[model samples]
Target: MKILALNGSPRMKASSTYHILAPFLAGMKAAGAEVELIHIRRLNLEVCIGCYTCWARTPGVCIHDDSMADVLQKFNTADMVIFGTPLYHFSMSGIMKTFIDRLLPRFEPWLIPHPHVPGVTGHPERVQKPYKMFLVSPGGFPEFEHFDSLVATFKQMARMENWEYTGEILRPGAEPLSRRSLQNLFTGYYTLLRQAGEELIRDGRISDNLQLQLREDLFPGGKEVFYQLAEGYWTEQMDKFKVPQEQRHTVPLLAKDLDSTPMAPAGSNITNDTSKTGDRYYVSNEVIMQTMTAMYDTKAAPNLQATIQFQIIPPKIDFDPGEAMWYLEINGARCDLHQGKTAIPTLSITTPYEVWYDIGIGNVDALEAFTNGDYEATGSQKLLNDMLHLFPRPEPGSDDPLAAELDTLMMGMPTAFNPEAAKGTNAVIQFILSGKGGGLYFLNIAEGKCTVQRGAAKNPTMTIHCPAETWLAISTGKLDGHQAFMQEKYRVSGDMAILLKFNTMFDTHTN
Candidate 1:
């Protein structure tokens, strides 16, 4: 199925709207569908010339001679017409509005004298099929009625063209989109697009399952779409997730599940402290974990196919023994996990991509990303500093498409699969002792997964013998990775240069 997505952001794909849509489109492509995303910003689109050559010369064709002609063909030729734009001033971008305005020429004055709605006049006899209007807009909060008023303009276009409203999809929390969120949105959105295409070509119906999952996964606040509905329009988002033929009713009939609460609450603030010291504005990183669970958008659920872990090197921690260790349920049982019971809460983070998503001049360092307004930091700044950090974006090499793709390949050693540290020039892999023997270890950059091991192998190039609690300090650079060397907690032999270079690798990567 052919799905044509018109990215109407004036900045084109660089706009926040397009960033979110990219993954969804990619998912559609992955699902074996023909999906073409055309950026309106790249087109030399001109304002309508008001010449009615389309009617006399060719109906449904604009002859003003501009790129809209190509866009129009794409629109008319596809099973789905995806219109993406960021809400600029409580309305669609001028880029999209102007484009929509030009399409007015496609509407001929067919003067059909018809009855009107309760208050309106001269309405179409019947809406046509196949031409569905798919709309996309991104906002900071769940409520977008104010910003999404563009639907009215789109409705007018649909009315004139005699097409059905496939539906307008609103993407919440689209403003200040993160690299991870962008990838998720693109993946989810494209999945729907591809599914829509397949249904149109083969089944003559869009896959309801895919649509619901997409809405639940990407638009967690979609339940609010019907707050103003009369009595029953406030149903499931077409219950695309509720399987079984009988329960497979589209969102039209599914009533609101009152118990369900939406994440990305309107006006909600997100603060992540990237600092790694006593400056923890949020508690011991435990509050941060609770906050993540609280703000979790189950609609955009993550699949744990890949793993990354962060091993906090020690003496970095500022917390005292009095700050109660967070109680965690593990392996169908209670504690008995880490010795000392304070398994420095390891954060295994995964989004659409790894840490290096932001490209080019806009990119900032890990510390700067927090202080310089690159990320939303409410508290726990030091926790970020205490944990792994971002490395500089690597210089691009070769014209490889996958290079342009996300960091699909692993960047470093797996924390769980602790490999024997070879005495490779200037460095030797070392793990800060949580105990003398058995426990999980993490890598510097947060490639997450649980594994058993507490100390390095005998005769390892460098051995760090700090107490289990010092993992945080060593990793954070507070205790100093080299401190173990001086205090004898860390012993180095065999190859010092290789161990030095190895330590430098951790500098570029965080713990």
Candidate 2:
């Protein structure tokens, strides 16, 4: 069987449409079907002028001399034609519509009763030949309903032209298919597409079950998640190119070109005490209060209520004088910051401003500082320990664990995997750790088994980003994963629901 596949995406090979189409064509080729793929954007086809010259004057020949003549000849001889396009405005792309219009020479001008329908009238085929038509489209939206109109149009076209409509391969939320970071997550989906192609060639039709599986959601998060990621990608492109605010609407920027530009080096604000100057580096009382407010995790101690007071002695400096006092009131899931001391405080910490600042910014560990008598505390010993988990530190300190330690922890994850919890799970979870012992690692989980890989994954069901120390602390049971996540100690992208399952799915204690 000879197949002609015309790709209508302007992005050509970089398009999500091609991402799905390529695998299907590969499957057809593997099944011994002769397949020829062509990009419609590369053709020099002219628009139809509605001259009716092909019907009355030339008969089976168009007036305009362009690439369409060659395409028409190939179309006439092929046993099957696959129209591959990216959805635009709930319909086929402009170039695809133009390409279809130029095929008027293949049909006669005389109207006749439709062969497939009872009351519909259509034009007769100029050259009688049995062929199959298939639609291959990928849309950015996550809903399958978005492709309904486009699919209906193609079905109607197949009926009018006296051709068999051999199903369609529709992918919703397909933007990620073209993204390099997300390719690994779609490995199973691509394999299914290939199988569909092989079945079509060998059995003359794709099974209904296969078609239903092809239309499954590309990303499990659905429409809201897709919109957020798509908007973020475009916003990142604009920022990468430094597109001016006034010209944002007028200027067109391509992420591919902008990615080549060198990025500015990231700088750190944390400095040693010796570098502190009255005009430059002193941490103000306001900064401490704001940091406390931002780091407070209400979910950490939702039921327990308490009041914590801080008595911060100011550093001896000419610009600022005297001590600073602040207190926090925690009630259920709410935390409020107030100036001055609170009456009947559950916990009271009195420390020099410099030492407390060091602990707050992750320069020194709080437990070490407390052990060395750097601070005086008069309160519940339980509250003191709970405070660390209640308001988790926002960043990792200067002393980060080594890469070997992280490797040891990652290696043990597979052994700790609970097959019962992961019975129905098939996913790739990527961990991107930064600072000191930071590197890329991913877990491939399938059929109740888990494998660890040390490089980037082509596709990942979810991605987690955090400092090496943070991950180490979480892995060793020193930190609460959910509390750290709520406190913004780590960031995550992709399926958040999967992250919530970590506790039950893996035994961190054994790791």
Candidate 3:
């Protein structure tokens, strides 16, 4: 079964909606369903103009390029669509809303699904199928005002395009969600998501008969009550309904692509009058446009793709192998909230493939699945996002970034561990690991040797101790440099700055 989960929170994986939706996706995956997750805030697509071009001129094409094009194809292949978001100012987030707007191109004037082929004759399937949703709001409220507003808006939009509205679950109170509650929510949510995915994958959209039954059970009061409750006129009466006074601001941008923006070439200048700051904010228009221009203008081959790798930890943005731009085919793409304000796990999918598959491709979004327990990742989010961004879209003929080529004929021999990288000649290796059973051990500088010990001051010179097991794993490639730190398998005290510098001098570890 194919399921597409759309996350509206810009904070990426940290968003509460992501948390709520993850378990559900896990359930689906466990049931043998294929799921794809698309965080709308991550897409570089632009907003839909009010132009009814899809209904008149281009038919099924929306003149924008950004990432919507990235989603349209995947949307068609899925049997279910799961929309997720936090209720902002009593409504859905601007990101998710704008995304829904751009989707206009996916529907014909008659609101039919676009043609899959030129003249093939087949059933005129509905534009979308019955779907489910998981929304996460920061705090709890007894009333359903916020939940109803979000669901109604999406429901109406789906209805206009011939989609069957399945059901939704509103998860209120973000931090208040305990591990126990999370598990329970996911158990039920997972079952429902997989069931929805399976039905869509097997029989296209849900049968009209089944859709009617599910709708009635969930809605209870039928369409009349639903429409009445949906009317904005009721909102005026709702203000007196007495709810929490919590004030929350929605995100400023949506999944629409900036690179695909149709405005005057951006002229190699992309700056923020006021920068939002952070990875969700990304490298900004200027950096990307500059990179794009540099890649295309260089005297290199016409097809050479250019890429820049940066390691940024605030007050410390460093570039490697010389801060020069090199032609690197965008061999792949990864989700780097390099700027997400929310705690959403920045996603990274690494492979040598030329093209990228969207969160909707597998009919599921990655973060959402992870949050719902439908997706599983082996490491910390920061580690995941960082590694994913390192996905090398290598320049067609460039050497591997991780491995250095010493001479023209042969590859350099790899090393197990280099004391030079971990320990420098600061009075002959003054290593220390303190507090709660943490300390240092000594290893050979030249012969690649080590003897791990427990007690204190055991010879301050040339020491290395990071949870013995981790130290062992490091030499064996069983542990990755990034994850080791995240997993607490690696932590350092004392001269960390100097410690990091050792990375440059040490013999590179290899498999």
Best by TM-score: 2
TM-score of each prediction: 0.36, 0.48, 0.35
Give the per-residue lDDT digits (tens) of candidate 3, residues 1-511.
6778888888668776776567656655666778899998889978778788766777777777678876988887786678877778767788988887787765555433334434333334325455443333432332455467777786765554456666565654343232343355344443454454445445544455544432222223544544553464347556644333331121111212112122121222212122222332222222322222221212222221222222212211222212121112222221221222221112222211101111211122334434443223331344333322232111111343221121111111224344545443442233222212222222233333333321222223332324333444453467775577666554443445544544454443312
Q: What's the candidate order when arranged by decreasing TM-score?
A: 2, 1, 3
Q: Sorted on lDDT, highest at the top, how do the candidates line up?
A: 2, 1, 3
Model 2 lDDT per residue over 1-511, tens place: 9999989999999999899889999999999999999999999989999999999999989999999999998999999999998999999999999999999999889988887777999888888899899999998788889999999999988887878999898887888899988898989999999999999999988998998888777767777777888999999877765635642321122222122122111331212233354332244665565455544665677675677778887675544533488877777676777777665566678776776765664456676667666777765556776777776653332244466778778867899899899889888887766545655567998999999875445567887766677888998888888888888788776788788777788998312
Q: Who wins the lDDT comparison?
A: 2
Model 3: CA > 4 A from native: 110-143, 178-511
What global local distance difference test value does model 2 have? 0.77
Better of 1 and 2 by lDDT: 2
Q: For model 3, state the Cα shift of residue 274 in Å.
A: 30
Against the correct fold, how does model 3 do in TM-score? Answer: 0.35
- For residue 405, model 3's alpha carbon misses the true position, in angstroms, by 48
For 158-232, candidate 1 gives per-residue lDDT tens digits of 665556666665665454353443455455555565565455445544566755654543434354532332123
> Local distance difference test, per candidate?
0.44, 0.77, 0.43
